[model samples]
Target: MRHATQLARISSILSATLPPELAGHVWFAGCDGPSAVILTDSPNWVVLIRFQQAQLLEALSHILEVPTCTQIIVRVVPEGLPNGYLTQR
Candidate 1:
């Protein structure tokens, strides 16, 4: 439905919005209300991006015109796991 489209759009936007240094290391996990969740390949990226969250939110808000995101939640995948695969954490 409408929410599904919104989520997909968010994921696409995030793929392009992440910093080059962080690109390919993270992905859009999903959203809750206006909070956007991102999962990274490693804890290093998680810690790095968490400090840059304000800029990230700003980047996303610029690309997002509807179903606005109000927050960013960054998480790390389990060590030794592959990237971009969804799993219960």
Candidate 2:
């Protein structure tokens, strides 16, 4: 429950931080220790997000009031599928 809440908060922050064109395409999936897990609807968005990884981490750190995330794990998960499918596969 706490984890989900944190992810939700991060997602909200990410939505605001990302450009309008990329906003709805990216989301905070979860966290892996000091790393942030991200999911995107397309591989194209993954590439774009990676280009902004450093800035995104900094924003997340400042917004969440936590230590800077050490890494980001971005995955492509097609839209309309249940998010849990990522773990299942």
Candidate 3:
């Protein structure tokens, strides 16, 4: 339940921080400890996200009022992807 709350808060942060065009395309999937996972449809979004990672993390840290958010895991999901999706390193 705590994790759910945390992710929801993070989602809010993402929604506000992301650009107008990129806001709704990302979904907050879940998290393990301090690392949060997000889902998006394309690799281009992932690249854009990577470029904006620092700002997102800063926003999250500011909103959460702690340094709990240390890493972001972005998973690209496509219609024809394999049963098990692979996240970029």
Residue-level lDDT of model 1, residues 27-88, one tens digit each, is: 66666688878777778787777776777678677766564777778877767433324331
TM-score of each candidate?
A: 0.61, 0.75, 0.66
State the lDDT at 76 in candidate 1: 77
Could you give candidate 2's per-residue lDDT for residues 1-89 as a string of tens digits?
A: 56656666677777788888887776787668988888888888888888778878888888767864778899887655344333322
Relative to the true structure, how large is the alpha-carbon lDDT of every model? 0.65, 0.74, 0.68
Candidate 3 per-residue lDDT over residues 1-89, each given as its tens digit: 56555565567667778997787666666656887667777877898777777877787677667877688888887663332222211
Q: In candidate 2, residue 12 scores what lDDT?
A: 71
For TM-score, the strongest prediction is 2
In TM-score terms, candidate 3 sits at 0.66
- lDDT score, candidate 1, position 28: 66
Q: Give the poorly placed runs of model 1, Cα more than 4 Å off.
A: 1-12, 79-89
Q: By TM-score, rank the candidates, best first.
A: 2, 3, 1
With a 3 Å backbone cut-off (N, CA, C), the pairs that clash in candidate 1 are none
